[model samples]
Target: MSAAGPRADVIDEHVAALSAALHGPARAKSRLIGEIRDGLMDTAAAHAADGVPRQRAARLAVREFGTVDDLVPSCQRELTIAQARHTARTVALTSPFLVACWYLAGSIDQGQAWQLPRTAQLVAVHLAGVATFAALFAAVALAATGTLARRLPTPRGLPLVVAWAGTTASGAMAGAALALVTAAALATDWPLLVCAGALAAASHAAVAASARACRHCARLPVT
Candidate 1:
């Protein structure tokens, strides 16, 4: 029987598995996969140039590229940062809307068309300020703890500071939420109060998730 030639299908299948481990923006993930694929093809071609069989060249390229276990950690860190960025953004974007909703609901309950009562005004201003600060801090945390920051050979104090800043921001949000809910109850704006409570709860959950992801990223070895 004649010997069978090397199968490109096997090489492509290996590349596909390797690509699945990468996580980030769709475009970036696609680019990474394409680069890996090209490199593998080039490696195989080089081996073929040297009279090595195509199947053996593909296997050699994959082996040289490292196993799936070796590739996953790096991808995992990127994925974590991506997730943190997404959650932080969610908190930042939603805070303003939630604050507006609370104010609107309170104004409606009080029969104060667009004009808020003096106490409502004060409370709204305070909540707005807190939510704004939290949003700003979310931006800071995302920037400071991204994948680029984690790639340093020697860990810097900045990551730790960013980690702490994320926790502090989350705490500030929670405290503000609690305060708003309490104030709403005292003002007897029961409907607005409940809305504020829900918003606060959701914000707290988001901040907690973001902080956790950042913490995990921070603990990863600086590579």
Candidate 2:
């Protein structure tokens, strides 16, 4: 009983250091740390079965696991890829709903439907088209970061690419919403306009947060 204490403590300290050296999506980071802990404990047990002392076996496991410096680059890269996948997934999923927000707002409107100016109509169409292409691109990025990653080597700077791609897609969607909202301001009652505005703001805020996390992960020097 007394001997088991230091054995566990050494393993715990090593795991704590590994967890501290990594930063990314919380869920993904936690999973990685847990896997590392399991690996260490398994290795230590194998050593102890061969007549090694528990405490010494634990220390040997840490040495075989490599230093924090050696592990950071690969660990950070995986975390960054996870971040990229998350951002891409967000952009792909919410895109259609943003378009629907405009139609729904107009559908529930209490005021008369007024014809928008030709310029406003054209601009809205253009923005909607851009948003569609952006969303498609985000979907491709998501696939690349996800299923495709398992078969091929991860591309360098993929996190940065996906982060900006998501931001651009969300921004275009927001612009489309703005154009529609401004054009329909006189046609809809205050309540519907407020609803539209609130939806757009909330969606954009979520995209901004996800994109920010992507950026933070991308900026970490994996070398």
Candidate 3:
């Protein structure tokens, strides 16, 4: 019985030491998380006082954290649950537009209108030009998305709306470009139209799926 008692005491001492070590880290992380959350709230409040839209406020709040990639990793390290959740939500909302842009670019690249008449060739060339622009836009969006994923704040509400609206408009322009290219392609080989249309549709669908995932993630309660 005497031997067992000493063994039990030694185990208890070790457990206490381990717990103390864990507690220190936990408290530190909690403090850091609190700071980030408070900062975000303050930014929101300030933006509100300025009569800015909530989305813009959210975006500006995030911008204060620096770039998305830098912010995400920092938040992750601190285990800032609220900050992480908000950043994730922003990314979710914007992913569809990024995906759509990429899809449009690819469609333009593969469209068959370039093989047709002089007018059709000109239209195809224009479509290609538009694709090049979309590629650049996609690159930017990808960087932004990656940054946001890592824990950066993205613009919310009005700014988010404006950004997405701009993206949608760009998509519309891409569609128009596609139509011009399609028309020219049909003047040559009608079969390519099906492939081009499929590519566009598939890309749009992919974006929608990505957007859905982001929305779903946003709705999840933070632990």
Candidate 4:
């Protein structure tokens, strides 16, 4: 982003267009933009050193970089991978806490209130197990798109896989949390209930936000 010349201004506008056309995790997008800017500037500097006018060098650099439409599909691939990895990691990391919250909430009741009904507890436990399995499945997707990516043919629609797995895992976590909340309320474990409620809120919020970004990235047409 040089501010000194009309050609620099043109290149800046070009870069902005490229940025506008992309959507993904902010960090990944920012990193990609930074790399592009640095590259353009470096190329412009090289031309300037070779006796080209600085302004003209900037114009040449912009042209050499190709059009936004040409660059964005490649940039988007990277962003989509970053987004998918982030979502999978969040789901995997949150799974343990999701289970622990339920376990601790139920255990700390101490009989101060009515015991949770056995049937409901069993159902909640099974649902929590489902959530755990989904989280683990997300981890598998993570691996597929990561280290194993180089070793295996990248499956088409891998982003969709990550999105759905993360969504299912987070959705199941929310369901089980809601069920546990009901059981806690029935048992009247106020302190335990609040703790579990907070955990559920924070964990679901993180997973849901990442899953949403993942979903958008998955559905984003080969831009």
In order of listing, the candidates' clash counts read: 0, 0, 7, 0
Query: Which sections of candidate 3 miss by over 4 Å?
Result: 1-128, 145-186, 208-223
Which runs in model 2 stand beyond 4 Å of their true positions? 105-128, 173-187
Residues 128-160 of candidate 1: C-alpha lDDT, one tens digit per residue: 566677677667656655554577432244444
Can you give the TM-score per candidate against the true fold? 0.57, 0.83, 0.31, 0.87
The residue pairs in collision within model 3 are: 55-156, 55-157, 59-155, 68-147, 69-147, 72-150, 72-151
Off by over 4 Å in 1: 1-42, 45-51, 67-84, 98-131, 140-163, 182-186
- Which digits, one per residue and each the tens of the lDDT, describe model 3 over residues 1-223? 5523533343334333323322112444466545655666676568757987655665566567554344444444323333323333433343344344334333434344454333433443454445444444544554544465478744333223323433443454346346544553544444444444444444435433333433333333322
lDDT of each: 0.60, 0.75, 0.43, 0.77
Q: Is candidate 1 or candidate 4 better by lDDT?
A: 4
Cα error, residue 61 of model 4, in Å, equals 1.4
Candidate achieving higher lDDT, 3 or 4: 4
lDDT of 2 by residue, 1-223 (tens): 5877877899999889888988888999999989988999999999999999999999999999998888889899889888888887787776665665555454543434565522334554565566567678788887787788889877877789888877876686667567556755665454555465456556666676788889888999885
Candidate 3, lDDT over the whole model: 0.43
Whose TM-score is higher: candidate 3's or candidate 4's?
4
Ranking by TM-score: 4, 2, 1, 3
